[model samples]
Target: MNLIHRAGWRRGILALAVASLLTLAAIEVLSDEPEIALLIGEPYKAMRQRSTASIDPAIPGHSWFNAPKSDARLRFADPQFGFVTPLARFFTVGFSRDQRIDGVRMSPQIEPLLLDDTLKVVLDLQEQWRNAGWVPIRAEEFPSFADTPQWRDRLREVKNVEKAYWRAGDKYQLMLVVSRFRDNKRPTEERYLITLGIHRSRGVQ
Candidate 1:
C-alpha cells in the first residue's frame, strides 16, 4: 500500500508540473506583442483582422481608414502599441497584386502646438531605431531633392529641408525628412514639418 501511494503521489506531482508549464506557455503567447515584420507577407484579410483585434480602443485618436486612392491598402492611425516608432500617427499597409502585404509605412505627426514635446519624442524614436540595429543609408542611395519632383513640390515653400535615411540590413529602410518653414500667415514665426517613413526593401519583396 505504501509503494502504491508513493507512485500515485509522484504521478500527481508530475501532472501538476506539466499543467503549470502549459499555463505559463499560454500566458507568454497571449502576452506577445504583434510585430510588423511578421505581418509583412500575410494576406490582407488576415493582416487587417489581426491588426484590428490588437488595437486598443481606449487609446485616444486611435482609428482605421481605407487609404485614399487604393482599395487594397488599409491604414491604422494612432494605435496603442506595436509600432516601431512611438507616437506614430499612421500605420499604412499596402497589398501586392496577389493581395498579400507588400509594404508598411508608419509616420508620427509633429504637432504644431506641442513642438517641444513632439521633437523630443522624435529624437527618442531615432535613438531606439539606431539601438535596434538600424544604420544610415548612403546619401547616393537616395534621390537628391532637386531631382525628385514630388519632394520639390512638397518643400517648395520651406526655408530648408534636411533628409536622413537608415536601413536595417537589407530587409527594411527608414527615411526622415525635416522641413523648416516660415509660417505663411505669420512670416516672423517659424515652424517645422517632419515626416518619417519605413519601407520594406524592394529586394525582399
Candidate 2:
C-alpha cells in the first residue's frame, strides 16, 4: 500500500477507538446511578411534597417519608411486585381533605396502581413492620394476612380495594389500604390506589 493510504487508515482506526471509549464512558455513568424519581413517578413526587407538612407525633423523629426521591434508603412501587420496602427506614404518610377512613386520613389525589402492585406494597410493609413488632390484626372491614399464605394466588387476582391493619410497639398503629378503580385518563384501563397512614392506637395495648 502507498504511504498516503497507510496514513489515512491509521487515522480512521484511531478515531473509531476514541469514539468507542467515549460511548463506554457514557454507558458506565448512566448504569451506575439510575433516576429514582423517574422510576417511582408522580405518586412519589406528590407524597414527598406532603411528607414535611403534616407531622405525626407518634413517629417522633426525622420522617423517612420525607427522604429525598434519590435517597438510597428507599424503594417502592414496582409493576410486577406491587410495592417493595427493601429498607425498613423508608416510610410513607398519607393525608387529605377528604373524610378519614377508620380515623386515618386519605390522600385526595390517590394514584391508581395495579392490584399486583398494591399487594406487593402491603406485603412489603407488613414484613418490614412485623420485624419492628407490628402484629397483624383481623377485622371485618379489612383483609387479614395472619392465616393466609405469605405467597398466595387468591389475593393476586383481586381487582378491588382492600385494607390491612397492624400495631407497632406500644402506642403506634399502621393502616394500609389498596383500592382498584378506573383510570380517569384511560377509561378502558383499571388502576389501584395504595394509601397508608400511622396514628395512635385506640385499642388496648
Candidate 3:
C-alpha cells in the first residue's frame, strides 16, 4: 500500500479505539450509579412529576392507589426500572401520609419461574444493590416479622425461607426474602416467591 494510504488506515484505527474506550467508560459510570428512581425525602408532588417523566410510552399497566393512613402507591405491572427483573409481576412505590416517599417493593412473577431461576434473580438483585454502595448487613440474622403483619402471615404459608439485609451508609435499607411453597393447584409442584423492599433507614438495631 502507498505511504499515505497506510497513514490513513492507522488514523482510522486510532479513532475507533478512542470511541470504544469512551463507550465503555459511559457504561461503567451508569452501572456504578445507584438505580433508585425515587428520592427518599422528595415531596409527593415532585416525585410524581419525576416519575411521570420516566414512564415509557409503549409500556402499559400503570396505576396509582391509596394505601393505609393516606399513604399512596404507584404500581407498574411492567416497570422500566433497570434494577428489578423483567419477571417482576408488579413494582410499587410507597409514599407516606406526609406526602413523601417511604419505600419501594416488588415481587417476582412466580408462576412462570423455576425455583433455581427465582433464587438467581434474587441474588442478582442483591449484587446490583451492593454495586450501588449498599453494604451487606445482618447476613446471619432473620428479619423481624413482628412489625409487618403481612410478612408474618407469609411466613406461615412458605417453607425454606431466606432473608438478607443491606444498608447504604445511614440513609437507606434493603431487605430481600425468598421462599417456596407447595402449589395448591398443582399439589406435586412448588412455587417460589421473592420479595424485595427498599426503604429509608430507621436505625432499627
- Among the numbered candidates, top TM-score falls to 3
lDDT of each: 0.51, 0.47, 0.56
Clash pairs, candidate 3, are none
Q: lDDT per residue, candidate 1, 29-64, as tens digits? A: 644534332245555566545542343222223223
Regions of model 3 farther than 4 Å from truth: 1-36, 52-87, 110-112, 142-158, 184-187
> Which candidate leads in lDDT?
3
The regions of model 2 sitting more than 4 angstroms off are 1-110, 139-141, 145-160
Q: Across residues 52-104, which tens digit of lDDT does each residue of candidate 3 receive?
A: 22322211232332222221223321122224343344456566656666677
Superposed by TM-score, candidate 1 places the C-alpha of residue 26 at a distance from the truth, in angstroms, of: 25
Candidate 2 TM-score to native:
0.43
Candidate 2's residue-wise lDDT over 1-205, tens digit each? 9999999999999999999999999878644542221122233344334332233322223223332333222323223322223222233333222312112233212255555655565666677665556676665556554325542444444464456787654555656765556677876655655566556576833
Write out the backbone clash pairs for model 2. Answer: 82-117, 83-121, 113-192
Worst 10 residues of 2 by lDDT: 95-104
Q: Please, what is the TM-score per model?
A: 0.49, 0.43, 0.56
Predicted structure 2: lDDT? 0.47
Better of 1 and 2 by lDDT: 1
For model 1, the stretches where C-alpha displacement exceeds 4 angstroms are 1-38, 53-65, 68-83, 88-91, 113-115, 139-157, 181-189, 202-205
